[model samples]
Target: MAGIIGRNVNGNIAYLTALEPALPGFITNDHKFRANDGAYTEVIHTNAGLLGYVSDLGHVDFYPNGGTDMPGCDSAECDHARSYYYLGESLISGGFTGRRCATYVGAMTGNCVLWGNLNMGGLVPKTGSSGIFYLETNAAPPFSRG
Candidate 1:
């Protein structure tokens, strides 16, 4: 585990280290770091000096005011099961362009807007299949409902 060795303000030797991924873009399961392995986990810093997660399907999930979990859900709930919002295949082709985003099943909440396509952890009635969902927050209004 190679890492950068440096000293803190107090002059004591300190180590600033993070694990490097074995492969490029092959990371999974960790939320505090960039999944790209070589890349440092990036964050969006607010004017108020708050650090927020960036929107990356493989990296991290962004919620309103930079929050990560949807409010009012239980740990056993399927919605909070994952850290990142599940981007359905071909659901968002061009990526989030407006202020608001939506999901088919998972539960999330944040400062931006959101649209729910189906109940969290529920099967999609039209397809009869279970789905995962997560969406980043934006400053625009929601584009769809349900």
Candidate 2:
């Protein structure tokens, strides 16, 4: 089975790194990798919010509003906290959606002409998908325009 779940392993890097060679694919006897594995993503809070942690290899990386200074948030707290809000909203209401361009690099510049649409933070993962995504939300509750 897929083994040991770890997070923020900064302190244990050396130990973990040392064991990497000995372990077989990180010691997973039968680890199957998929695109939609648990909504893997890096959420970027526009404005006020810190750059925070980023996952370069996630199936989708959500950059809401495409800026650190989220449009509706009055303060940094609201902007940063919007990540949690977005997740909660996704569970109940229609989730936020992001539009990126053809390539990961092009998408970042806000040229969303391509069909790179992805829903951010969903109960079910978006399978067979991988790329950076961007979406805009309302300032208040029922944030999703969907």
Candidate 3:
């Protein structure tokens, strides 16, 4: 489920942007925001593997390397290999007076800021104020629809 998801001049796995949440010269994480109830979360990936989880509000917690058994997960006795992360709260802020993707900001501290009329990869807001969002292996169009 990892490595070489695409091919370009050579190979393309992930693309990191020079946004706030990312390190100076590296893209080391993947993110997804749930807007149904307004939640933003990300999975921390490292050279070793999935390091742990962090939220937009300012809560950080990591998992220790262990066997497949997770101790205080739930009644199902969760598996360490199969874990889930959640957002703590909404820390979205900026002078941006435009419609933001998902919850507006990157959802995590230092994360990038993507602004436009659409969320980019998911549902258009119920207010019908967003535009058609698409994600492909090509350069995005240079037009904005309201």
Clashes of each: 6, 7, 4
Ranking by TM-score: 2, 1, 3
Per-model C-alpha RMSD: 15.8, 10.3, 16.2
Q: For candidate 2, lDDT tens digit of each residue in 93-136?
A: 74777886554444345556766577776566455566676677
Summarize candidate 3's per-residue lDDT along 1-146 as a digit string, tens digits. Answer: 11112222132222211011222222343332111212221122111112222222111111111211233334222322222211111112211122222431232121323455322212221232322112111111111121
**lDDT per residue as tens, model 1, 73-109:** 2332322322222222113432221233343112233
lDDT of each: 0.25, 0.49, 0.21
The candidate maximizing lDDT is 2
* After superposition, candidate 1 runs with Cα above 4 Å error: 1-32, 35-61, 64-66, 69-77, 82-85, 89-92, 97-146
Instruction: Give lDDT: candidate 3, residue 140.
Output: 18
List the candidate 2 regions with Cα displacement exceeding 4 Å.
1-44, 47-57, 102-109
Q: For candidate 2, which ten residues in a row score worst on lDDT?
A: 13-22
Ranking by lDDT: 2, 1, 3
Taking all chains together, each candidate's TM-score versus the true structure is: 0.23, 0.61, 0.19
